[model samples]
Target chain A: MQPEIQPAPSPASLAREDDVLEAAVRWRAEGKAVALATVLETWGSAPRPVGSHLVIDDTGNFLGSVSGGCVEGAVVTEAMDVIDSGKPRTLEFGVADEAAWRVGLSCGGAIRVYVERID
Target chain B: MDLALLTALNTERAARRAAVVVTHLASGVQRLVRGEDITSDPLAGDIEAAVRAGRSGVAGEGEARVFLNVHVPPARMVVVGAVHISQALAPMARATGYDVTIVDPRTAFATAERFPDTPVIAEWPDKALPGLALDPFTAMVALTHDPKIDEPALEAALKAGCFYVGALGSRRTHAKRMERLAALGLPQAQLARIHAPIGLDIGAANPPEIAVAILGQVIGALRKPAPAREAAA
Candidate 1:
């Protein structure tokens, strides 16, 4: 005998990072400026794994995630700057950042995010 | 940030081909490497190895710093039974990142109330399997004790080149099944692909434990190299 069955949650987010990449490509092809940010590395109890991504367009629209909201705002901010300057930059966030403290990741983890404009 | 490279990735994904996107961080140069087209890329060996393992990560340092974003089609599982084992296996398979579909013609067994997480197709395997598009990333399991239900699914799995195929049966049952399949013109090589006992012999006495064993075996067959898997089998 089996218990009452509940509908399983959709696993649509499994390829979310790839979706962001595809979206970035499409946005660029449409002549909209776009920047791609990836979690190149992480340490301690980081919320997201390495290779997590956040793709941002010029209008501030974004997709995917480099962190569990702990560092997306900062990454988005850096992403916009990268899109404007056409220069790639690396960002670091941990409990050390007061902003990170305000959001979360109070678990004391650090992450290295790289942002580059997709030309 | 190369549009060409990104476009290539999108194309490969659309074709359901596995690939890896390699990017050099400092210079921000990127290239898309499909598993089959690795020889054309300078980083052929490394990128192919990474994609085969289905893992993405950063390698090297300084100017050589490379990020490999491995991409493979999502894993899928086709279960040919709406029995108790499927009730346990479907959810467990979903938890293990498999897109599961349960196929059982018996409406009483293959109902939404029984397999809430998967698409329950109330059609025989021969009728339902073709639409599922079982591929290298798929694992097929025939859990129905009835040969009418399980054999057709097993045939479809072998023909489709599914990565893992298992059927629930005891040793004597499997011996009889092998005879029947052989008489049906399935080659020895194709018939060998079936893991007749279904799950790993881990002293599994209940449905959930059996499900775990089956999923574990499927994962092993998926993750291990073919030669190594042959040796283990």
Candidate 2:
């Protein structure tokens, strides 16, 4: 169906399918293990939607995106770790909560994701 | 490795299972709120709260219902007709990350070239369907208007328990189609599952627009129910 954007292999962007495929394909071609993280749902003013996906390769290489460049780096790093360990991970991004504040969620919105390795 | 991920995706779409998604926010303009990286404990952190605060999607923008679908085995879309509409739809459908198969008996029309990246089956419906292992997670669409092709494929789809079974046609065409389906011994109640005039009434005319409408309806039906307390399991 009339793609949301024009053809000719558009540049990568968060919340784009090509971005994910691009990263995954690149990683596969380069002989790296890759893992995929998909956004299942978003609440408040989040950047992406439920079906948004992000992929990362074992060498820390990555493609596609799940947020407004707010958390791709961290997500990619996490994906690499998940692939290395062979464990599925569910990550979260959201508002301020007491205790520990390691990951900064700038949007004040919440996003849930499921991460699994893809070789 | 890829197959495992696809399987998970299929499970969620087929069973409509609910699960939370976690995102790690980055530093930027406006707000910069930090939260505990509580995903370490596997079952740690308040999933509902985290998802809500993150604004996983545009909050409550459009009337689009959001559900945390756990793709148990991954989802697949079986397109019974390798027509132009399928060409437009296959990639888009893949975007939402559904495995796609284009089925058509026309050798010339159902070639890998027509559907560049999809699995194109140049065999008849009966021959093609039996091999696909149709499951509840499967979604079948008959884009070809030929009764010879669509009828048997649809019968197989109904028996396989596909979540969404749609056919490309107009309201008038659907009425006539019902007659054929009835003659084939498919009950009216069973026939109701078929989205005869498939796709939302977007008033689309072209192939791409029509494909969009069809995919939209398919997405809506396949997505898990909204957070209506009553519907929650």
Which candidate number has the best DockQ? 1
Scored by CA lDDT, what does every candidate get? 0.84, 0.68
- Per-residue lDDT tens digits for candidate 1, residues A1-119, read 89999645424543343587778876886889999898878889988888777889998989889888877887887888898899888888888887767766676898888888887
lDDT of 1 by residue, B134-227 (tens): 8878899999899999988888888888999999999899999999999989999999989978887799989999999999999888888778
Q: What is the lDDT of residue B35 in candidate 2?
A: 24
Measured with C-alpha atoms, the lDDT of residue A83 in candidate 2 is 86
Candidate 2 backbone overlaps, count: 38
Q: Which candidate is the best by TM-score?
A: 1
Segments in model 1 whose C-alpha atoms lie over 4 Å from true places: A1-18, A96-105, B38-49, B179-186
DockQ of 2: 0.15
Candidate 1 interface CA RMSD, Å: 4.1
lDDT per residue for candidate 2 within B1-233, as digits (tens), equals 35433443333333333233322323111111122233443423344343333233322223322222221335789998899999999999999879999999999889888899999989998898887878766889899998889989888888887877899887898888889889989888678788868887889889999899888877766664334311321
